[model samples]
Target: MTTESAAYTADIEAIAQVVAAVEHSQQHKDPDEFLALFHPEAVWTTAGGKVLIGLDAISAFTREVLPAADWDGKVTYEVVHVFFIRPDVAAVKVRQRYLSPGAESEGAPLYVMSRQADGRWLLTACQNTAVATA
Candidate 1:
């Protein structure tokens, strides 16, 4: 589990569940559900380029934005890649699709997740970037 290969091979499904939860929370506009996926000192950068540090800031942002989001419960998140920094840490790339019919868009989010003592993965740091049309 110390080598990169072992780390990469470990917990792929478990880490994916974290991303899946994000999709679900986003689709449902459930701030609490989204907040539960973060580490206590997690950092998140929104697609709009706002930087939020710690759970408090992340929580505040999510509470306000998620509830007011106009996605209309149509969205999906897929883990496209995962690179292990350690046995308990991974850098995950995700494709986030805003499935709002005619106005569909996509986001490429990179999440640095860490496994907790209880073996649960939480998002430790992340940057969400919008995929602009050419």
Candidate 2:
């Protein structure tokens, strides 16, 4: 493989790790860890349609809801696609699933991540949509 290809793969892997951390934080209800993955000026639109602008708003919403979420099992997030808008920006499509004793549901979330000057990726904008069944 070319050096460029290798570097790109490494970058994607790093981004995947960040995404995994997001899943971890949510499943474990650790708001601090989840909030740390977002940029200070990030925006998030929840699955229920509440728009949170900036880290403070996001943190408030997450802290208030995540811990009180009434899921009997765990939540899992998987990266389904990754589109690079630029060398420093990416649009990630994620499949999120909640599994419990006798129920399951899913959501599709699009997360826009930006690579910081320090080479770490932080989520900058995101939208979570519930997967409706027909």
Candidate 3:
């Protein structure tokens, strides 16, 4: 295999762990574990367009949102594209899908991003919304 392929694979593994942490936070409502994967200044936005900034906001939002969700679903993260902004930072476009369990079923592709630093990837910002059709 090529060196670039190997490096990209390793990067994806690291990012996948971060995604798992996010899912764990959602399923179990473990704010500390979720926040550990994010920088103190991380930002999160919901599919409906509400903006949340910083660790404090993220923590609060997680607690508020996760429990209220009747969503017994799972997420699969696909790396659409990655642009290395620097030696330690990259911008990633991802596709996320959630499998719903009940009658009201729907899934959407989200444009999300993360950044790597100190050999770790952290979710810097994300925008989740329904994909528009052309």
Task: Report the number of the highest-TM-score candidate.
Answer: 2
CA deviation > 4 Å runs, candidate 3: 1-6, 73-75, 102-117, 132-134
Ranking by TM-score: 2, 1, 3
**lDDT agreement of model 1 with the native:** 0.93
Span of ten consecutive residues with least summed lDDT in model 2: 65-74
RMSD of every prediction? 2.5, 0.9, 3.4
Per-residue lDDT over 1-134 for candidate 3, one digit per residue giving the tens place of the 0 to 100 score = 99988987887677667766666665565667767876778777777788889888978887777667776745455556666665356666665655566434333423243554467788776666655544
* Candidate 1: 10-residue stretch with minimal lDDT: 1-10
Report residue 98 deviation for candidate 2 (angstroms): 0.1
- Candidates 1 and 2 compared: the better one by TM-score is 2
Q: After superposition, how far is residue 43 of candidate 1 from its true place, in Å?
A: 0.4
Query: How does candidate 2 score on lDDT?
Result: 0.93
Query: How far out, in Å, is residue 130 in model 2?
Result: 0.6
The digit string of per-residue lDDT tens for model 2 on 55-121 reads 9999999999988889853999999999999988999999999999878899999999999999999
TM-score of each: 0.93, 0.96, 0.70
